[model samples]
Target: MNFDELLSHYKAKACIVSVEFFPDGTYGNIRVVAGNKAHCDDMASLNHPFEPGCPYEACFPKNPNFEEHCYCCVHEGKPLHAYVDLYMMGLWLNMFLLPLDSDQENIGYCIYCYDVTPKADSSAMADLSADTAADVLKACIKLRGSGDIKHAFQDVVEDIRQICGSDHCCILLTDDEKCTCSIFAESLRRGSSLYPMARYIEGFYTITETWPGTLAGSTCIILKDERDMDKLREQNPVWSASLDYAGVKSVVLFPLRHGGKLLGYMWALNFNIDDVIKIKETLELTTFFIASEIASYKLLNKLEVMSTIDSLTGIKNRNVMNNYVDQIVEGQVPMPKAVLFADLNGLKRVNDEQGHVAGDKMLRKAASILQSIFHDGEVFRAGGDEFMVLVSEIDESEAQRRIDQVHYLSKITDDVRFSIGLSYGEMDIRAAMRHADECMYADKNAYYMANPELKYR
Candidate 1:
């Protein structure tokens, strides 16, 4: 073959790749045997001058996925294409491979071409084969059309499992700050021996922490056979041993990331290795949408928490308390057997003598003490320096004992004194709140009568 003539006809970073064929159906020494001028320029720009028959790693990074694609293209005699995010380089790569005629018996050849862009092109990403496009589009519709997000996630994971012909599929979310990982959704094929991920969730984050290093700048990890597993054992022994113990022979793992932050991981265990390329293509696109959805879901949850929680004291705010009251009034919720009102005795004195900062600290301390004592009840920051506790079921004796304990605990914390009043036994919650307020004022009056020097209007 006139390799130079073959090279002169092309334009966009094209090169001829040769793979050494073996009798045992394995490959060795993938090399870039020839290149067009554009490809040579690319190599020169990377400080690696073009050398015929140089190892593929001489110019590009060593990626197992790339190697697999090259081997498959040469042996299978088919064209292949992939659009991948090169996160380490902050680039998106659109690549293609086409098998070439080779006269030699011991070597197979293919032409590889690619283009790079700083950001993803949606059209290029959507240019998928009909089957892959249908599969990915179905997942997208399920994600966007469902009101129940958790159920939608379950359905999508099961779809992925079926598509991959795998024993199990799982989406695991990670919290690096807490060093914890949770199974967001998972589907296991019936009769499969794999245990549910929940059983190992106790310290799985430690294993998850090792994944980035094992991936080693690639976007995913695909262990298709024993050779790949051998490489994984060298890269990550702990995870490899865990997979071996779990009876996982083949797996595909992709990280769920949005805006450069890693949200979690999606993986399939014991998948059909014959369709590795198809599975990789499907998951690459599917996880992009999944990560975006998960990020939005997390943001909404955080906003809801902010709205319902007291910012200063970290307790339920008055808004949530009002909603609970409405539920009780509507008979949607059972009436509490006990209601207690606790008013800070001398917040104004603290603010006047020291500062509002000190008064704020005192309020937080008071809220903490109330939370510790009424752990079984609903504690709310009802008003400025006032808190309310509602117990769904408590006898009068136990209520009085808790009230006495609160008084004693407050007395010991000289800076945090409370005028507490309790209404025990089932009644209209509205009436209980009013009675508790009046009793609280009466207790405040008694405290002032005993210690007039510390009293404030």
Candidate 2:
């Protein structure tokens, strides 16, 4: 359409206009007054009419809804006329009109198009914000349920990045024993100098210097410089490596807490304030909530560890042994496997001659010996004077040789000796155990028959 006519048509609409196209197809700086739909329709029909001979006729169709003219000549990705057509369509409906090129062939349309209608209600933005928060909360809950403090922190880092619109996130956990810290997670960027997935650290000075609270639970430290960083790294090796690994000069640590105690701290890295709202307050609150979940997970993990471990020997207990065997018999445990049974021979002699204290010593010493001999196996005290072994990838013949070595060595110590019975193969472990026990009794009898004086009565 002619510049003056198009201008007069849209003048009354008060729509913002920054660019206009002239009859010569060149861009022109233009301003216009607003108008009603009829005025716009009249202007389109007068100048850029829907006639055969019009140069701009390629853009305007006989659409009654066509409003003020808008030329998309500025978008050089496609033909100028096609862009103009799309731009004119957009003006009519307040919608997106992506132009396409004919050379696209089999690749489908070259341009993308969409119609964007103004949201009638602003509350949808609020709903979107709430929905995002809920999703982040659910993700944090899933991470916490994993029973891994490190993994939970990692998931929180990613969640925070999504919520905060940042490029990366991380978790820094304070070591209660060493008073040091480490990087638990980060944006899985791969590089030798990048943030190592598992690194110990102290504190990031950027957030900590202005943090106003203890470093243990500090959040959102924007790295401003290197002055305080040296002091932090000097405090611990873990701190130094974590900082270098995360490639983040600025960091925030949120202490995971539960039941009025601090469980661990999470870290967020590479701050992007533009994407996430209230980078500090939002992250702090989010971390606080996540900490409780992480704490519960850590507690469960500790309980699991305690359940499987023998307090005295620091190995799997009888309960663990039985459970492990069930797994092995079912072929759930990885093949190949074997079992060893060991009995301490002269415990009564030790109790009678050297007293109960000596007997206890003998038991502990025997356990130690068994541990050393079967270091490759999972060793356990099955009961008094008895032990069990679960060996992976070793048959009974190989196990018998190892037992002979242990037995031959016992001759060097006159005070304590042992009669060990071994059963191998992928047979029933309980029945194999019974066979080993009978064999051990047979050996014990042979030893007493050879030397009655050596027998403990």
Candidate 3:
């Protein structure tokens, strides 16, 4: 066959790929047998001049996913198309593969054509088979239509598991700063022996960190058989051993990314190998929407925390304290067992003598002492140099012990003193707060009477 002539018909960069076929349905060497002008130009630009019958890796990076596609296209005598993010290259690739008629025995041939862009093209991504399009659309609807994002993610993961005919599907979120990974959502096939991912999540981020290296610049990882698993073993022995222990045979893993940030990863275990292309196609688009939604959800949570958290003291702010009081007043929540008001005894003197920076440090020290003592309670910054601690489901004796501990700790710290007042037993939250405030003032007056030299209004 005139391979170059065949490739000349494609305006996009195109090449002829030949695979060494075997009788047992396995392949040997895969090589780039020929290339058109555009493909040759690309190779030359990379300093790897086009050579006939060179191993595919000579011209392009070695990718197990690409090898699988070539083998499948040649064996099945069908066409394959894919739109993938080449994250390593910072490019999006639109690729097409079509089986070609071959004359040689024990050899198969296919035409691999592709184009690249610096950014994702929505039309190229949406170009999918009807069934795949429907599946992706369903996932998008589930992600965007639900108010509870976590529950919506659960539904989508289950749907993805069923679509892949897999035993398990999971979305694992990664925190690089904390070096931790958490299962965002997961679905396990009924009666499957596969254990939940939560069992292995402890210290799993170390294993996840190795995935990008194993993927080797591909968009995702697909291990359809033992041969691919062997490659994975060579690439990541620790993760492979963990999978072996967990009884995972075949798997597909995709990194969920949004706005150039890696949010997490999505994976399926023991899926139907015959539907690899369909599964890849469906997830390629579905993960895009999922990552976007996850980014939005995380941003909203950060905003909520900023609004309700004290920036300086690193405790709940007055807004949250007010809301809790409202909840208790309206009978929406149980009355707290104890309320304690802690006012810094000499903040005004410290600010006037030393400056506001020193005063701020004193306030932080006070908050830290209160937090350490009432670690089980809600600690709030009610006002400048003032903090509130609310504890529920605790006996009066325990509350008093905690308050005593607070006083002892504060007394021992340098230049740190607290005039603390406590109200124990169930009562109206407003009245409890008023009583605590008055008691705190009385304690403050006593402190000033004892140390008039340090007193300031």
Candidate 4:
């Protein structure tokens, strides 16, 4: 029952460790309670062997920011065959933990360690290091750059396409909402004319919804040839049909995940090799880093959009306006510009007669009108009932056309009542803004005077 006696009966490589569980479902302190001399010699980082209450994780040197796989074994009560490489020791350790039967409520874990260092140089790791470097460099250049996302990702996909012996590779970035998952970006194969599987994008079986029969839900779904495709067809007819129609004899899909959420799926079609080992090895080498880059890009993009857009009207807000003015005024993007200042009429009347909800619809209507009129320019929801359009590098005829379009559209509906004031020429952004703002107020004053009841507005 004592530590030394318990250690004697187990394998020479085995160790007993105590792991403290936190309320957040994550393990905290991992202390090695007992181990054989051989286990201590290998695992113990210091000159002297670790005492009963010593940090297990720190003692085992690992990659920085490395998540311990042993946590899942102890906390989730799931048995796993996982290994960790102690870079300093150059020894790979395989872990197995069992729940200890102790009087104490939280006695922590009793782990068994087995070193698999001899098997580290197996043929399965064949050419992985050599292959990854070439792919990683090319992928990093494409993903990290400011090139168009699809185009950049397409280039990244191309690196893996031929490397993995695939005819085509594409990354489909997906957006998951409450009841649906939609493809946000499709980095399709280069020189491909039509999308034979385009129907599935807008069809019955979306990726996540159709494929939920895996451990991580991000598991690789590999279909080799017609029978394999047919088997999937019965499971999800639409998805299978689409795949078959595309004339893809073989396919492999790996879900690109960040944290635990699936961002999208990277897929390869009709590769030369059906050898699962090669396919898995190739994808395993590439998909992870690619997925991480994709996740960072998407999260950053979402943040940018949230900062720039008006949530209600779905138009560019003051944040965008500030950036636009700063660029033009600072001479960053020099061009002849036009500032069309627009204000909605009867917004106050609607807010007073009907509540703010109705007023919101009126504001949306006003924003829609502005967006329609100034389709070519950057339209901003400047204020509660105000809009501003910034058109850069515009000539007189183009400027007149934009202004004329606004004048003609304002008379279309009683609900969309608004006044527009434009200042267009080779001028500074601030001066144009000021002139347009003044003209807008002058136009507003004329409307108010005509309708005396709304004189205050």
Instruction: Summarize candidate 4's per-residue lDDT along 1-457 as a digit string, tens digits.
Output: 5767877777657777676767755456666777877776765545656666677654554321122335545655644443333323444444455555445555456556565573344332333445455665566677778468767766667667776666667676665664444544343455654352355556433545665552122246666566566767777776676666677778777777666677777777877643443555457546666787878877888998899999999999998888878987788876447877888888887888888899898788778877876777889988888898887667768777766766667667556677777787837778888888998899888877897786544
lDDT of 1 by residue, 1-457 (tens): 9887987988898999998878877788999999999999998998899999999999688987888889889888989999998888889999999999889887889999998999989998898989999999999999999999999999999999999999999999999998999999999999999988987889989999999998887878999889889988987999999999989999899999888899999999999999999999999989989999999999999999999999999999999999999999999999999999999999999999999999999999999999988899999999899999999878889888888888888888869999988888747899999999999999999999999998887
Candidate 3 local lDDT, 1-457, one digit each (tens): 8887788888889999998878887889999999999999999998989999999999888887788889889988989999988887888889999999889888889999999899999999888999999999998898889999899999999999999999999999999999999999999999999999988989899999988888778889999889778988988998899899999999999999998899999999999999998899899889888999999999999999999999888999999999999999999998999998999888888888899999889888889999998888999999888899999878889988887888898889877898888888848899999998988899889988999987875
Residue 94 accuracy (lDDT) in model 3 = 91
Candidate 2 ranges beyond 4 A from true positions: 1-136, 144-154, 165-168, 172-175, 178-186, 189-193, 197-247, 273-277, 331-337, 348-361, 395-397, 408-416, 448-455
Candidate number of the best lDDT? 1
| Total backbone clashes of candidate 3, pairs 3 or more residues apart or in separate chains | 0
Question: Residue 285: error of model 1 in Å?
Answer: 0.8
Runs of candidate 3 with Cα error greater than 4 angstroms are: 348-361, 392-401, 423-428
Candidate 3 Cα RMSD after full superposition onto the native fold (Å): 2.4
Residue-by-residue lDDT tens digits, candidate 2, 227-299: 3356456654455465665565544445554454545555555555332224543554465556656566567
TM-score of model 4 (CA atoms): 0.61
User: What is the lDDT ranking, best to worst?
Assistant: 1, 3, 4, 2
Candidates 2 and 3, the one with greater lDDT = 3
Question: TM-score of every model?
Answer: 0.94, 0.56, 0.92, 0.61
Clashes of 1: 0
Give the residue spans of candidate 4 off by over 4 A: 1-152, 178-208, 213-218, 225-230, 330-338, 346-349, 391-416, 424-426
The global C-alpha lDDT for each of the candidates, from Candidate 1 onward, is 0.92, 0.52, 0.91, 0.66
For candidate 3, what is the TM-score? 0.92
Superposed by TM-score, candidate 3 places the C-alpha of residue 273 at a distance from the truth, in angstroms, of 1.4
- After superposition on all CA atoms, how large is the RMSD of candidate 4? 12.9
